[model samples]
Target: MKNKYYLLICLLLSSILGGCDARWDQVLRVKKVQPIEKIDLQGIGAEQMLPVQFPGKSALLIASKNKGVLLLDSNGDHLVSAPGRVETLAIQSLSQGSLLVAAYDELSAEVKLYKLKGGIDRKPVLQYLGGRDEISPQSALCFYQNNDRTHLFTIGDDGLGHEYLVSPGPSTWELVEIRPLYFGEQVNACAVAPFNEKLLFSQPPIGIISMNADAEKDEERKLLMQADQLGEDFGGLWIDHSGNYLWLTADARLQGYELKNLQEGSDQTIYIDSNYYPASVGVIGKNIVVLDEEVDSLLYFEYEPLNPPEHPDLQLVDEFIPRIPASAQTQPVSSAGDAADDPAIWVNRLHPEQSLILGTDKKYGLNIYGLSGQLVQQFAVGRVNNVDISEIQHPTYSAIAAASNRSTPGIDLFAIEKSGKVEYLGLQKLNMKDPYGLCLYYMDSRLSVWVSDKEGELHQLDIHLGQDARNWQLKHVSRLPVEGQVEGCVVDAQNGQLFYGEEDRGIWKLDLHRYSAGMGKPKLVAEVNTKSLVADVEGLALYLHEDSGYLVASSQGNNSYALFSRSGTEFIGNFRVDMNRELGIDASSETDGLAVTGANLGTEFPMGLLVVQDGRNRMPSGRQNFKLVSWQKIENILNLSSATAN
Candidate 1:
């Protein structure tokens, strides 16, 4: 009986110890003592801090739980004061001695906007700017500024958060809703790393979580440190001056995490005497200042981030690629989430300057944009994925548009009048299991459209027009069998050459004459090699030179366009479309279908233009849209100006 009781007691002890992580009690034992200094705020209140600098002023912007804001020097001397009853503060730093301030108003659970101006030995002044009528909770809020654009993030206890684009107005600042993000649990503290666009939030009982701060990016939360891993209690969180270390504070301790690559975690724990309990933390110059309310003082620690960010080879390769800014972008598609896919250019022969851009919203219909990137027309056709427009030498119509309709499981054909008018010719039911890619090929006065299913089945159909303007017909031509899936295709009318992308395989070229005679099969023209053409080759467009031109294909895997010589079918070069700060367009990625025209269409497009589908729409992030790049810029970058000069 004594042995049984002893065994049961041992089992109970093991279960309790297992349930309660022993590391939770190890924080005090492992951390080493560090030298520290303090500021006595015994009566004033919170030292919740942020660092700011101007032309002639540089100090820590201190926040008080009740007494407003104060500017404290490195030695803890209060230099400036602004009256308000705010517990938290966020700053959006700007140039010319101006910075945006967000002070949390507890009564309303919202934040009031203020613009601070102080420089050239002048006293800093804060202005009461009008803010939005509705807002998220400011209890856990921070500002993320990138490329001179400021964004406000507010997270609530319910794990719901709102992200806003902060736009300054005449006497106010506009808060535009970009997206609503979820944190999934109660948040203890939060911080933002602008350099990598990462949002780190501490969710107690679970530990720290980091996610992409950009609404246009993947917003999946990744656990950086588990609750058991954070040996100490988490009180405050802040990103260090280098934007490399994500520092978390607790009772007498600090944990710095090198978050260059979140997947490869590297961190260090610095534990101090347990006499301090930090409630606020931030960076001032190269030192760390922690607000410890237990003694009503701010503790300053002389510390620097330990290690440099780890950059893998893939990251280096990404930085090595040259970026080309966009000059203009079309109005976003009406639908969202992978809706916009392909674009087709419809050149008005009568007024070539007024050529229109046709884009497909795979979720809804079609959209047409003008040269200046304005919405001209929108059609509610159902789920058209890939679209192509070509000059049709028909009696009733000058041009026609063809697309693969996933909703109807058929082909949608439309006619374009000489005056830029689009009339629906209706859908042509086909024998396709799942039609995915469609392209129009106009050769020798004959108009044909090539359509492909997701399973690599390809079919060509000749389009015929009746005497009536809206009456159009499609007759099945010959079928071309491919090995795998295909999407992008283009035809060289002058050379009777047809090029199609087999996605994972590569680009294939088929001779129209040989295929017509049933002699040979489509041969691989370009393999989806990592050197140039990445897998899932998409959106093929031919730039017609004097005689032989260049074949531009979308290297979908890499967000680049690869150029191949039409004469030898050899890869020449590739270029990526990058962000344009002036135009507020983000870099193009995961491109779908693209269309290029070599004909000089007036002054704006003197050397024609290239319209490619922007897979991800960002920078004041909205829905997806098509980006237009000048052929001149592409030629100049690739040195194709001399090659295509003719």
Candidate 2:
């Protein structure tokens, strides 16, 4: 009888352990990564492809890991890969059939350059630009042709920008007539395009300057636009094939101007709503391709004709289903529930219904919902502060949620699956005061997460989730002192940097990997003088339009937003969201939640879509209870001189 009892006990134990193993398996399954859905426009390439500019006759090129530059033909059938690896730092195609590539040399401080013929077989062009030397090959090189000669212009770390004239003398090439362009201020990058044997140089926080090919005498420079007030990093510039129109990326927007009118101080600007941080921009035929390195997505937008092609009155062409549900039904499945706040979409393969939607409720628990708006899983996290999703690996995605109580303060980890199963991964125990915002990114090829607190401090947490997402762990990496309440955070992986916005202190910059390695410290890049723009700032976005860059921040007070150049030193203009005027409501409207979408100009919903929170009528009163605005109307509002006049 004792032996029989032992056998039964063993069977029961095995059953319980098997159940736990199954639960763990489901949680790790959440890591499966998936590709985002693509929206197609006429004359646009696949959404997954990064659009790059090639030389004449060739419209666009896409970067490949193994192959060099893959040229995209008209039929999309002839795929040709160029020979060299496309450097992420600097890649520019010169008019004289040469491509300039920039990469880090043996010493991290010096940037090396290589000149390639037909996108392959690179030859070392320029070696190291010493620390004291003003120019570093790391700067973005602009190619322009004047009087049958090509010129390369770039700004270095020393805040001095130079222009080099390339003279090809039948046998060898030489860089001559190098002259100083911009001084005192750092030139992030410059864009050059030819117009009637003259080159147009665009320096942000300021407008465009035209330089002619005169070796001995200084060329006459003309101001195309006034940008000093717009904050120094306004955006990049793009000139069309005919050099008729100039495009600028400013404050989460794309503005186009007529080239001739720009020279005469009669430039007409049209705004396109682009939400992603635009890093680089290119013109492919009539379509505009923008790369947002932060979001890891490429956008293709076409120019709309002065007159409508088919339908002039059309506003919206098509509307895709909201990846995140407008409202989630709150109910307790196995644990507890409360009102949901801050819903974020996770697009990955493991939990595919778009994976998961994470939010917080006052009931001290983190809520997880499936794509169908059903509560499949719940975690007992204490007062969820903020949540961020990072794509780790297949069958093992990680969700970092900051949870803290008055007594215990730390971040909780949850490994979940599409089936609503959840597992409690360990937490990074930090004695922080009040952790509020969290942002995650891959820096230096390592999975790192950053958390910001109310006391104006940012902390980095290193997450170690094995390739098989089943096991996960977290370790405290580093912490940096900051100012104001850190609200919004983003990581520029391409540049290996991290940015956070202070409620009243403006924007702060930190070297992610360098800080993680305990080598460098965080520094202040720009301060949004609260006395100037707005009182309370919440959200921050760095939009890199082609070579130009813009830093956009949200001012919660008076429902307005401010634009600055990429460096965050200069102010461009202040744009107010008159919810009452736009929605025809009262002054009681409060704006929250902003997102930018990219669409072709000629399409029905060209420009893109802007999602905002409407407070006119909250739940249990209004029909939809929220407002989703189109980008076209927002563009019209932003472009209005009176809206930004204050």
Candidate 3:
């Protein structure tokens, strides 16, 4: 009996430890610490804040909202002031002990550079350097000099960061051609490490991120560390003079982080007054100062690194499960011969919440579903392999829809009613054999359709609406020859560019206008030789923002999605969809087609939605179905440019 009891106790202990591990894997551990409020800034308010020191005295440089920059001592005694109200400010030290201060105004989106001459004993003279440039005034600016050139990096409210180079000749600055790095998080504060050009940016909820200052590639902005979620109480962030620690003010506490293993957890924390929130924080030598608007005082505290006990056996796990992410499975479409092959999202302009998902049932036709995965409409048009949707304004009716008809070698036209139902209009017969994939392009007050086949033949047809809004006619515009079997294709209406994936070789791009006119040559965007992109690059989709975008391709051979710059096809990163145990859906593999939309689609997909055909929906047992992945999850995992992060 005693032996039985011992066995039972061991089992219970094992279960408890397993449960703890499961919970730990779901969320990251955030060490919370409080700092004591020390000194205050008796300035106007915090529009911009910077910490400065000269010769033998330390001062706080406060750029008041509409009052300008005030240089004040530790006790709030005003020493000097620069009269120019600005949105943000950046300071750089010159060789001769002179200071260059650049102030930006949001209302004008202009930056004015000023040179300050002299010391704290006398009121310094401010000289305009004639260095003016346009930038997002709402962003925080940081200046760093490299190779005799001054570069100003801005963290924008849109989460799209930009960098500008100041010319040594005139006072001119030019925007660098670096691909936009989307943080997907509002950067509350930022700092640069002069040692290796490393950048540290802080955001609420997730903590701080360190990326290379000259991050021209996506992999360079790797995740470093995540701090406690301060919610709405997030404050400013600063790196110490030694570049070994990062300081942050959040939840009324001034926190310091040591840089040994940044990807694991924060190193130290100091608590301050709970009643006052630290609006801005800066560190000078061994003293940390904070600005509290509620108390109308500047608080300073002596800083010291705290030594915390280490948990040698404790293992830290990232919130994401490596490259796999959880996803939701749509209701299955029952048809054989690779039935569920492709999908398209149709936004309901009336009730965006009621947006419908249109997927291809290759053996049958098109299947439409509600946001809840309930099949609402199914059109038996005939062996449709791929489907794409675009809004076309007709005189009598509002829009018309089109799909490639693989069974009969033609294109099927339809009209999409506001009620999420598609009405078949007519069919435009094509001379091509075995239509495989199709996409629609609408721009310049015209609509055109592109279709590809198994033999690598591509055709562009300019669709014209006849007198009766229901009648449609296709005008053969151009035909292009490709190397291998082709299927996936998409057009960037904004830039008039065409991108298509050649299953066995790689992805290619060409000018849409010139391609439609049969006058342009195709350029290889990415090839299968790349380790990140396997052979059989199946589906291609474009994620477009107002100023930037990314091209996502389904690397079918590897079961991962590869991203590239939409402008020049620059390689970004790759990710895969994994099983969501709670949702009872399996990981996607051997995907054939995918579609993405930036439009808001209710709560489940407030940011956007990515629908991909899951070749093995349940894996080893169930039928194929489409999977629904929250675009926000992909953004956080890949740090893609997303307004949702903002």
lDDT of 1 by residue, 254-356 (tens): 6566656544643455555677787777666656677776676877776654444554221222334445677789999999788999999988877888889
Give the per-residue lDDT digits (tens) of candidate 3, residues 620-640: 235668888887788878777
- Could you give candidate 2's per-residue lDDT for residues 122-152 as a string of tens digits? 3213322221122343333455553334555
**Which is the leading candidate under lDDT?**
1
**Model 1 clash number:** 0
- TM-score each candidate: 0.79, 0.38, 0.49
> Who wins the TM-score comparison?
1
Which pairs of residues collide in model 1?
A: none
Question: CA lDDT of each candidate?
Answer: 0.74, 0.47, 0.69
Clashes of each: 0, 23, 14
The better candidate by TM-score, 2 or 3, is 3
lDDT value for candidate 2?
Answer: 0.47
lDDT order, best first, reads: 1, 3, 2
- Minimum summed lDDT over a 10-residue window in model 1 is located at 15-24
Q: RMSD in angstroms, candidate 2?
A: 32.0
Candidate 1 yields a Cα-based lDDT of 0.74
- What shift in Å separates residue 24 of candidate 1 from its native position after superposition? 14
